[model samples]
Target: MSAWLPIAPCTPRDCAAHEGARRAPLAAAALLLAGCALTLLGVACVPGVRLLAPSLRDRLVRGWAYAVVRAFGVRLRVTGCQVEPGRPATGELVVANHVSWLDIPLVAAVLPARMVAKSEIRHWPVFGRFAALGGTLFIERDRLRALPGAVHALAGALAAGSRVAVFPQGSTWCGRDGGGSFRPAAFQAAVDAGAAVRPLRIAYRTPERAPAGAAAFVGDDPLAASLWRVVTAAGLTAEIRVLPPIPAGGEPDRRALALAAQSAVASDSANRPAASVHH
Candidate 1:
């Protein structure tokens, strides 16, 4: 079994606070538009608009999102991306490590995936509205009664060939050092839907500073301030690695598969070749 380790910690809270203060205007602008974006997306969900493939629309939305991130001064660097020969049909489940709240837009920039986000996100002004418009599947962490329905909805999406991205870690972490653990329940959707699991890893490295934990931005640490500090601080880049796809069936067990994927990401050398081992 391979052990996984995080590449870095969360950025310093002090730094995040400092930068966020400077980028207030930009953050406000983004937040304001966040609602308009969702409204536009909701309109696109109409029957006539639904005719337009959600994947297609998702791609456009993703592009816009990437542009937004860049505009906000964040640079994304992707590595160890294994391009499978034959692409799996839509509805495949993508499992990734949960790092920070920013993971959503970062992942969206790469793949056409709908996130399985927390229900609270549904209430977040523009973000919530757009997420719904983009067909995001919201799952309640509590209220056991809602689990079944949410699972059904996810399964239905997979059944129809839509790729859903799940953060198997369940919750965010301070970084790898902060006992980054994977929650097995997040894997249930892939198992139930018989979809392939694509394990993903994201590492955020501050150019001149260090990394922080998931809570790096709350409390007195204003959201806008933390984001700006990380964004404008020289050449900070986030590295996202997508390991090879694992078919959700047979032998190696889900735990073993999870470890395999975890190992691929935890490995330090980004330039190292990805191993293609089948059990």
Candidate 2:
């Protein structure tokens, strides 16, 4: 497999563990309904994204992003390095470990940026419209030849002073044991554009801070199933830890920058070995 399609050992059976208190069925249903309503509102908001001034755009995205998670009953607690909410982060690359579908909105809650997403997502139901309206950069991961153009497009966006977000692990990992390796390919865009990289570490935990895997959206885990687990898990808190941004000149190259960002992200956690990917 190409590096863009890095394999993860995480599967729905092994990694998506149920943790934390669960909501009553009726309550869970209510939360799901709320999430759906917010999602519709978000889709409506996306068309205005490119029209609004940068500050208003960021504010709108950030607020709606937080509302999406909150409506689903996930309490978000952000910690560590903070950026001003209204200010635009020019030419910034926001990087985070992939854990669940929820990771997308979680990052947006921090900083609104052009998302580098799988091309398939651009065809997903209402989400496709949302992503397209918000100006997502879709990459054809299965087509290895398409990678260069994707990188060039990402570099171009950054060069235009637009903030961009990417999940460089290329696959989702359960945040326990350890998240999978960060593929260095996306970092090249950062290097080419001379953009700063903001390393964000994300974890879903209980209100008591125990690692919760109910949010893991790994191999073959249906989105509907994951959404059910998330909204039904009562007191689920998402830990959004923002590490210091790595300056554009901090590393000599993208490979080194990727490694440096990975080290910074994993430094606080005792990264135990995750299950290996079988060829």
> Largest lDDT belongs to which candidate?
2
The residue-by-residue lDDT of candidate 2 on 1-279, one tens digit each, is 676888899899998978567899999999999998998988976776679887888888888889998999998877776576664445988898889888988998887888998899989899898888898999998889999999999999988998999999999998886577788888999999999999988888887777888888999998889999998898888877777889988999989999988887788542332232111
Worst 10 residues of 2 by lDDT: 270-279
RMSD per prediction, one decimal?
6.7, 5.6
Tens-place lDDT per residue, model 1, 251-272, is 2455665665566556565335
In terms of TM-score, how similar is model 1 to the real structure?
0.71
The clash number for model 2 is 0
The whole-model lDDT of each prediction reads: 0.58, 0.85
lDDT of 1: 0.58
